[model samples]
Target: MESLSRAGQEMSLAALKQHDPYITSIADLTGQVALYTFCPKANQWEKTDIEGTLFVYRRSASPYHGFTIVNRLNMHNLVEPVNKDLEFQLHEPFLLYRNASCQYTVSGFMTRMTVTG
Candidate 1:
């Protein structure tokens, strides 16, 4: 799993563009999900599951608020389909998958990894 994540991070944009389009709709891909998130505790990317909506990132005070989307488990390296409902906020950092062809399903903000005091 770790190796797959690393390989995905190493994928160049040029290579992704050459791959086939993410030729499926959300309804079609829901059951066949491939989720991803950055774990600060683990200090690496990890696979996860999504129930409904996935918040990729919230607008942070810092200027650097972009996120990376990766193709963790998908074999074909399909692109992320654009959905108007998937995006929110204009000025704030929006969910922009760097590689249009990488297969990582949904990118979003997850509270599952929070440390409890």
Candidate 2:
């Protein structure tokens, strides 16, 4: 029984490593829009619109450690039709960088729109 349990644990760990070794905590942000205002100068506020498919993960060795966000352009880019079934794949190389506040980091390409009121 002990040997079987040990073998099962090793198999599970191996499967996890084979799935995704770098990225963790991924979320789908398809068709989501974010609205915010930025104060560039005194008594002035600029409205901004951001929309994309967000992919968040944590990678210790990554330059942008801690929490990172990725904007996946295509919804189906991360998945494919395999034998009539959908299979996930991590193929994109994200360009990581810290935000202005230095809190977290953001990666990949995202659409940014400036709203004029």
The lDDT leader among the candidates is 1
Which residue window of length 10 is worst by lDDT in model 2? 79-88
Q: How close is candidate 1 to the true structure, as a TM-score?
A: 0.24
After superposition, which runs of candidate 2 have C-alpha atoms over 4 Å from their true positions?
1-22, 27-31, 35-37, 42-44, 62-117
Query: In model 1, which regions exceed 4 Å deviation?
Result: 1-11, 20-69, 74-78, 83-85, 89-117
For model 2, residues 1-117, the per-residue Cα lDDT tens digits are 112255754553343334457533322222332222334465443323333433333333443222211223432222111122222222233233323443222233333322121
Residue pairs with clashing backbones, model 1:
55-108, 55-109, 56-108, 56-109, 71-104
Sequence-dependent TM-score of model 2: 0.27
Residue 23 accuracy (lDDT) in model 2: 39
Every model: Cα RMSD to truth: 15.3, 17.0
Model 1 deviation from native, Cα RMSD in Å: 15.3
Q: Worst ten-residue run, lDDT, model 1? A: 22-31
lDDT of each: 0.31, 0.31
